[model samples]
Target: MTNSKDLAREIVEGTGTEVEKGRGPSQASQITALARERYELFMSEDGRPYGVKVDGANIALPLRGKAGLRSQLARIYTDAHDGSVPAQSALTDAMVVLEGVAQAADPRQPHVRVARGDGVLVVDLGDADGQCIVIGPDGWRREQRSPVLFRRSGAMKPLPLPLRDGDGLAKLRALLNTDEDGFRLLVAWLVAAFIPDLPHPVLTFRGEQGTGKSYSAKMVIGLVDPSGAPKRTAPRDIKSWATQAFNSWALCLDNVSIIPDWLSDALCRAVTGDGIVDRALYTDDDVVVLEFRRVLAMTTIDAGALAGDLAERLLTIELHTIPDRARREEAELDAAYSDAHAGILASLFDLLADVLRVLPDVQLTERPRMADFARVLAAVDKVKGWDTLESYKATARDAVADVLDGEPFAQAVVALVDRAGPGGIVLTASELLERVPAPDRLPKKWPKDPTRAGGQLKRLAPALRTIGIDVDDSKRGPKPKKQRLYHLTASADRRCETASPASPYDPETDSDQQEEGGRYRGDASGPPATRGDAGNARGDAALFVASPQDTGPDQHGYSRGDAGDAGDAEMHPLSVPAPRTHRTPGQDAEDAPQDARPTTPCARCSRAQWNAEGSPLCLDCRTAA
Candidate 1:
């Protein structure tokens, strides 16, 4: 009577291989050896043992879990027996297989969510077959096995083969149920996710009940990474969160009402790539290290004033309640979406192709937090004539505005500046703290002292600047303590400005410095500014005099104020294309609108400046004073 193990060994090692009765390997040992021959073992980048096996297809599995070595052994036993094996023996066989492979494993590179191959991108489908979608510049194709090893989480669901048709993304849009702006932002998020190398923005769905926020978010998750359970509850700990992230490529947290500070922070880290280590279940020095980045989306009723850091990384799309008449059954809606998903996926990949093609040419004047995302999306928008990036920026600006209105410190700063008037006020941290006491929302959250108050103001400055209240705490006052100086300035019209203020020093008053239209040329009193030289031999300052063709500079929309922050600064249109026809220096003055003459003092030297260069200052003003 052949026992299950003996039969399993025969089936795996091949039926009827003769061996000396006394010298033949035992059944379990023989099965383990045969299993080792059938599967490949390798170490993870972090030094954990993993196995890859082929049973008509290749798949990578973890060595530590039942899903890996243990599962494989069970399958082999079942194949040989043509029926179930005793549970105890099956478990023992799995342990033996694990020991066999783990000892001889070799090291290899590992990928989390996605991988880049030669001129191609391999996106994990998270399907049971361990298949991946391989995309190239020409188009995309599905593959049974990946060119690179991917550590897949069992929770990841499979994505359908993308369809190619004339329909475009029509089906997808109907299901999303958002306005044009929301749709564009959503598309941007989708496009950003496929490119794993860049940091992805967090996508959030917001609305009251019956709005179908969860359904919409679920559809997105389905397209990117389909899962049996599309949404998950908030993880209890960092390790738990990592586990959730590792198991799924697209993380959807449903019904999130509030994001605590720690979770908010963790989300930020996860989107940009985060790593963790936990002590192994029973070992002292052994630890499990997981490093991952995920495409994170969530559905919420009201997340409530997001943390500033978190808000910066969010693409918050507000959804509207579905009218009772317009609302469809979840089953019906999901069915339609599932049917159209393939086509929608194809459309997104098409957009991604265009993005990658035009990425090298994307020349953004400024970069935000996820700049790579911004650049590629901007490239696609420019090429496809889509306003996605613009819509995103507009949404960001609105969020910033809301943040300013919501935060007491931010509101106080605006009030303080409004009281100071257009002339603005210069105050120390202690003085500023005295002027704006902490608001009542969170007493502990408010800055404790002048130093903390100063830091808080700095943090809120970027948001405040959007409302034309610029905060400059970079410069500090002299001395025993070197207390920081808070430079609060505002536009009388409550409009933000990016151009540096023109100098207050009047070159017109000095005959040697003044040229036509009072524009400064090289100092006539000093030796001629050596060709490119700015100032005299002593390095006093370079003052340029216009060549007196006598006309005002072009009317450039000018706002002369502090634009020290990167994103708040406005770029002038007249500065580009180098003026179609070259003009005599003073012809600029002739073309200028009389009102376009700049009145603000140069941020550096306080000298009144010409706006020809858009900001103030005739030249670099580091030494102009």
Candidate 2:
């Protein structure tokens, strides 16, 4: 009888016949060579082939060639037998066929096909055993490993996750379906999934807590690897997993609080065709350069935490909380999974494979903005068949609107001014600093002493001016003027007061009215008179010439008799005559007959009075003096 080695060698030679005849080695030849070597080594010292166990099934096979080949053959045989090779004799035949099948089914060669239906993909494995693995977008797998011959049933397609089974799953499905464009976008994502050199782009799921964000992510995970689900990772672990290069199918990072700058930079570089290296976890002395070709999706409460560069590359979806408890409960019921769900996912993978096979080639242009959006939408249309590319285009347009709208500095300055209130409409340099929200929140780099903050504020002056706010430095003295203050112009105030229906009536109006009226009316409660007015009156009084010895024009250029001088003299009137000496009753009448020295009039009484009672004046005179 011919030995197993002789049989294996004959098979190998037959497979290699084409290569020997000037044709290159066919995939069959390579597989036979590898398999034959393994079969020869499995022979025991007694010359009998050992039993190879694959997943509990046993196979008796001859091992040959390299030791590594023999070990691989044993594993492959065991895997074929569902982890264990049953009988040695049966193992040999099974090992040969499987090797042939694996070689023939090499996915590297273009043979996949796109199938119809939602979330469905069909991968055609030509001839040898004709096996197909059904998978979902979330990576879930079916328990039944059917033979390739089973593919003849019909073209496979992905089925939407059953939403009627459970509330949580239903909510997730509904959230995904809320935007019709999302389906097309998902299809596009699936198309990009097969490209090896593409960067590990991030998908952001943003929403409030308990709004089914996590559930939605889980559903995606289930679709991608039904057999082996993706592990939930922390933000810090992203670097570690990303360093593994293209090994992972997808990465789902949930609950990201603060995104580190390094991670953001790395992610941006990764998505933009700049591959990253992993120096932190290299096993060899030379650094390990890992290509992050995996698809990255993340969840966060606030999308703003992501870097602007990274944000541009992302496909963000906002999830809203389900309000009606009954509806939510009904959705949860629909999402409940059965064994059929896994089958649906498998069909979806086959559908995706088919789409990839028939997709039109797209050449992106220099217009990165439009190209990126187009690429995303195109992928969605090809994979999911959702027919919502236009809607996604709208979403892209919205994203662009947000990006190119205005500078963050302008917004910050406006916010500061708004908070400063009208009581202090003018913001002093120090007060401006105080009014500004934390420097960390602003986009501009802050200086140690907040000097840079002032510069940033200055840069926003033009924007403020556009909105009618003024930057005033007039209050500063002549040389080396102080920092300017920001004040809302009248127009600006009016705009503010009118902008809000609930704003109080203009407070400045009252103060303005009082000022305009008081200038001419002379407010009784105004500041006291100055020394300049007092000095002017004294100078004018000396120039006044009225009946007395004229003090003539003094240093001031004035004639003592000038009428203009009289007004000044009234302000500082001349002194009156002294009282006459009084006469005793028995004394000479000459002393009393002096007629009180011709009293012109008591300054206060305006009437002549006798000075008989000694040189005392009237009560009115005394009081006036």
lDDT of 1 by residue, 325-431 (tens): 99898789868886788889888888777777777788989886678888877887876788878777766666677656556777777766654424355668887
TM-scores across all candidates?
A: 0.72, 0.41
Question: TM-score of predicted model 1?
Answer: 0.72
Report the C-alpha displacement of residue 526, candidate 2, in angstroms: 29
Model 2 residue 127 lDDT score: 24
Report the lDDT of model 1 for residue 318: 85
How does model 1 fare in lDDT? Answer: 0.66
lDDT of 2 by residue, 120-200 (tens): 333322223333444344442332322211111112223333222323323334436335455435545544553433443
